[model samples]
Target: MSKTGPDFYDDEAVFATYQRHRQRVDTANDTLEKPVILELVDPVANKRILDLGCGRAMIGKEFLQQGAASYTGVEGSKRMVEAAIQTLTGTSGHVIQQTIEAWVYPPEAFDLVLSRLALHYVADLVPVFTHIFQTLAAGGQFVFSVEHPVITSCDRGWSAETRRQDWVVDDYFSTGVRVTYWMGDIVQKYHRTVEDYFYLLQTIGFQLEHLREARPQRHHFQDLQTYERRKRIPLFLILAARKAI
Candidate 1:
């Protein structure tokens, strides 16, 4: 079986480190991924929403506050699920502690399904995506972001200490489980190309609507240096697709 479920985040040290990063300003998730995802998932009012791998579910709270009809988050980590519950406290949000691969999709259920910087953890996308397709009502949108293929390709033969001026994108065509070192732990992430993601969704009966390689906008960033560094390479790939009516 392809390993799924809060593999690394279960580690207290790793989880703590990740939470710290999330709290920091100008991080990629705050500066690049969120802005792109939020724009792509606009007009959230009155939409039933599902969030996958919803770490802490801070974004889920935001969606609820934006007037989503209902919000459900599926998360794997026990710690994360607890934090997510706290985040959604006093809101119309429900959280399920399950991995994306294992969760059963309720057919034609949600108006919008969004995932942020997740999905790369799945060893396979076909089943997970098929579930998403089956769960979305006709005309419902699925918007998600993943670490860019160029960056995921660097799981091997790339050094983090390498100068920002250059990024070594090796094994672009070799797509599969990538062993990566992060926050003093070894983590496994699946790597897929831009074409891989597009074709997978297309094959699953989703009509592609929008695609973005997370580009930095001046207004979204407070520091000019962070903005310039983010511009060096696309750190995120966001896609929006709709189930045909």
Candidate 2:
């Protein structure tokens, strides 16, 4: 059973689950996020960067490697933040253990803001995105990734016939709907539809530059089944948006 809530991440077992699949997850994320970052950012000797919901600091580490002037990470999970600190010990960035919604920052503090596989956890996204817009300098980019809403709405469990299907797992159109995961007890994830995402961005004065669906890599497919399934259905979404000047 999957664990739920903030506690879902704090538990040792949850951390171990991430640890066991760390290599695969990291490789996949790098393949998707790094290229986007490269395309959006030119190398600069000194540029202030902020990584929100920066679990484990993998993306922040990449920014440092690319010669960011300074980097700061906001992470909600204590365990993940500690791991990130340990991972980035010798690097030039600092990790703050706080939720993005509650973390305070001066306006226009960063030249670039980045996040990965986060944002959906927030039940209310308007304030979060608004804060991000306020935090970025003019022309600064906010690059982040979230679970594709289509994939989230689909039932994830394997079936004897199709393995996966577009059966609705939860309400896609409802506002403030709580999705209980792993037997409806372990974890709860909230979601807004694709339309909701775009609408929110429009309201916040962010111009959407790029959007892509990240399907599972071919290496993950053993038989033709999983490969075909992923090809037909994506598992994740990657997006990059910039604050209008």
Candidate with top lDDT is 1
Q: What lDDT tens digits, residue by residue, belong to model 2 across residues 26-94?
A: 344554445555565546447888887777887677778888888899888889889889979999989
Most accurate candidate by TM-score: 1
What is the per-residue lDDT of model 1 for residues 84-176, given as tens digits with 9 covering 90 to 100?
999999998989999998999999999999988779998889999999999999999999999999998975555544534667799899999
TM-score of 1: 0.95
| Prediction 2 TM-score vs. true | 0.82
- Model 2: weakest 10-residue lDDT segment is 176-185
RMSD of each: 2.1, 3.9
Error of 2 at 127 (Å): 0.7
Cα-based lDDT for every prediction: 0.88, 0.71
Clashing pairs in 2: 3-186, 4-186, 4-187, 47-69
Q: After superposition, how far is residue 53 of candidate 2 from its true place, in Å?
A: 1.3
Worst lDDT run of 10 residues, candidate 1, spans 155-164
RMSD of 2: 3.9
Q: How many clashing residue pairs are found in candidate 2? A: 4
